[model samples]
Target: MDSAAAVSFDANGTIGAYQIGVLISCVLLGVTTTQTYIYYSRFPEDPAILKALVAFVWVCEVAHAICVAHALYQFTILDYGHAERLFSRLPISLDTAVFFNALIEQSVLGFFSFRIYTLSMKLYVPILIVFLSSVRFLASMVTFIITLRLPSLQSYNAHWSWLSIAQWSTSVVNDVVTTAALVILLYNRRTGVRRKTIALVDKIIVWTIETGMLTSATAIFMIIFYLTMKERMIWLGAFTVSSRMYSNSLLASLNSREALRSMNATQVSLHSFVSRPGIEILQTTTTNTVVDITAKFPSQPQPFQANRQCEEC
Candidate 1:
């Protein structure tokens, strides 16, 4: 085969991977919208700043989706039957989408970093997270600029590959560090708390780990693919999905607050019921008179006579 035919044959896998990535990112856009709606409906009383942040993130996600879709359409439809074009031409939409992804990721990271500061009542960890996130975003911006200037897809690996690697590396590091800080802060809060409260904290910690693992793992895979298959576009495909993970994780965390609050309230109610002052019991099932009276007159507003007043009456 001639050189042009060889390039075209190799480009097939890259295009296929890119197509799959675009589809997944689009699906995640739907999830982002749902989570945004849930947050607005459930947490109307949340601070204006928080509401604004959600709106901003949603808008960025929408923009990113548009760019990704446009890029795919340009390649598969606008330039159909011309695999040589894929090698010779670069899609502006693809590069622009990278910027939007960087923006979304940076914004989410900032929010989480602030949360870390609030929870830990400390500065160092949040600052570190912020720094790493900023570095990653800057690296992404630089990569986008450099890619746009490159002559062809083949040239990407030859020049400014380090920026691509740096961008993904910092993303992984930021996610892991932020997740560890939140988990540690939450675990510490579990101390000196009731069992139910501890359970609630554990749930939050688990979520933190899961989200952290997802984003970090995605970035790690992107790096691995980029390094191992430097000529292929598999890593770019992973990049598309990794961006969506940030917004989804943030929205998921926000929407869960109400459920966590309900769990806490339920636990408190159960604890109160089980520990009512005048409901003492013995081993033989010989119920106290106060318990009998309260059971009989459950609607009574006044406390019944007992060694201690019937707090439940």
Candidate 2:
């Protein structure tokens, strides 16, 4: 086959892979959302802010899945020429969907970070971080839109690269700040001095750190993949698919309902043990009157001494 034909064939395969990856991601997100709901249900007394944050994240995940699914359908069910023609015909709508999906993903992550901060009670810091991160996201979205509007890939400007870099950089910073907030919370807790509390905190911290690290790592990989696979659409698609799958898996594991349930159970047990009623002594008595006193004498050794002196003389 000619080079152009080979490229097209490879692109088709990539598109298929991307579709499958997106479907898997969608499934994972759905499961995660359900699990989150269960956790929220179990803790009806939890802070409203946290509940609202999780709800927002769930909605964002749903929107992301829908947009990705539509994008996949546009690319796969329709022929490339036809798909391109349609996209070109309604460029704004298609681009808007893509932009919104990306925006939602980042917004969800930021929201998660903010929730972490809220749990830690580091009020002003999270607010500042979210604001800064939102700016970065918006800037990246604008650049992405411009990139999409380009006549062709060859004519794509380099500014998009800068924007992607900014987005990822800001993401890393946000995660770092969130992790620090979690650390501060753990440290401030008197429970951390105890063995069980220490172990629990360790697990929580590990999961939080892992989530942040994985996100940053995946973002880096996507950036690299996008840059190198400019000519190979299949590789690009594979990268996108793998990135989303990895993210979904990490999120599902981190937000597992079972883990949250277990933590709650532990807390309840501790509280019950500490709060249970115990016996208390109410009165004390002292008796000081004494009647009998006896006086004893001393023994003399004068007789034995006289005998010893006579013997010595």
**CA RMSD, predictions in order:** 11.0, 21.2
Q: Write the per-residue lDDT of candidate 2 for residues 5-89, one digit (tens) a residue.
A: 5544554445655666676666667666666766566545434554565565566566656656666677666546442332232
Candidate 1 lDDT over residue span 1-313, tens digit each: 4577765566556788989998998899999999999889976755566778889999999988898889889878997777777776579988899899999999999988876654445689989998999888888888789879988877877777888888888898899999998888667655444454456667778988999999999999999999998777788888889878999998877776555544432111111011111111111112211101001112222221112222222
Whose TM-score is greatest here?
1
Give candidate 2's error at residue 193 in angstroms: 2.3
- Position 205, candidate 1: lDDT: 85
CA lDDT, every model vs. true structure: 0.72, 0.47
* Each candidate's clash count: 0, 0
> RMSD in angstroms, candidate 2?
21.2
Q: Tell me the deviation in Å of residue 46 in model 2.
A: 3.2
| Best by the lDDT measure | 1
